[model samples]
Target: MTLDWEPAAGRPDLLADPVAEAILKGGLTGGPEGGRKVDVAAIDPTLSDTAAFCERYGVAPEDSANCVIVAAKRGGEVRYAAVMVLAVHRADVNGVIRRHLDARKASFASQAEAVELTGMEYGGITPIGLPADWPVLVDENVTRRPFIVIGSGVRRSKLALSGEALVAVTGGQVLALTV
Candidate 1:
């Protein structure tokens, strides 16, 4: 099934973003049998938000994934994790995440905190190239899809990749993250 998004590699302009450039450089996942290869595509900045992007780009919500940064506190120390989930579902931050992080509670990172920690825009944060120490969690549902479009750590472009690629990222953990 051909998607409405144009191929990202064919357009050099979109590569200007570091995250998008890294993905093209090799952030993609494995081939079929393992997973679909990653792809990149430029998008309108106005459509960066979930609703607007899916609507204008002719992409269904399930085909797009949301990468969210969460923080938790334990004994006066702070830890973080990055989670990827389908737009159709929500991450169980307060439950599964808090337990996984072993924190008293887990909460979504604020716009400023997310941007500062990941060096990516709040709406554009992707799991690729996140701080290595930060746990990268992928909800099992995300991997079930053949292909998913995710943030490029910038609002100007999106990264397309197989569920395998996301699952294969070093230290990536798959869990039942959705409520």
Candidate 2:
């Protein structure tokens, strides 16, 4: 089916986000070596609840990946970041991520902070087009799926692609970093 985007409103071009573009381009190719085909679906931007969001799209929570932005703080300083993973597991903030980022403390990004840094509506943030330095965490469960649904750079849209294709394009590291 042909994909449809939301009405434009001074938003950045879909292609302007390199990560989104890469996923889009990857979807058009045959497979991993040739890229993967992505099926895009649009929805309401306010739907941040993963379970409800998936239900609306006729997808199970297990079939969807949630992209959450986290901020690590140390010495009274705050850092903005993003992480992507399956909805079935929570982020390993105290374990894998803390060590991965070398931060003494870390937690979910505040609503205002996430909106400001990522330039995405709270429920809509996707790892695509996120700051390059921010680490994209992939839960080990995600690798087990042949295909998964992820945010499409907007809360209203989602992309479905092969797991391998996403790994190749994002160069994301697979970790047992979920609880």
- Deviation in Å, model 2, residue 127 alpha carbon: 1.0
Candidate 2: stretches off by over 4 Å = 1-37, 46-48
- Each prediction's whole-model lDDT (CA): 0.76, 0.64
Point out the worst 10-residue segment of candidate 2 by lDDT: 1-10
Q: Which model scores highest in lDDT?
A: 1
Model 1, 73-170: lDDT tens per residue? 88988898999899999999999989988999789988999988887877889887777688998999998987778887778777777676667743
RMSD, every candidate, angstroms: 3.1, 4.7
Total clashes in model 1, counting residue pairs 3 or more apart in sequence or in different chains: 2
Q: Estimated TM-score per prediction?
A: 0.85, 0.77
Relative to the true structure, candidate 1 reaches a TM of 0.85
Compose the digit string of candidate 2's lDDT tens values, residues 2-56: 3342312222343226445555544443222223344455566566367767766
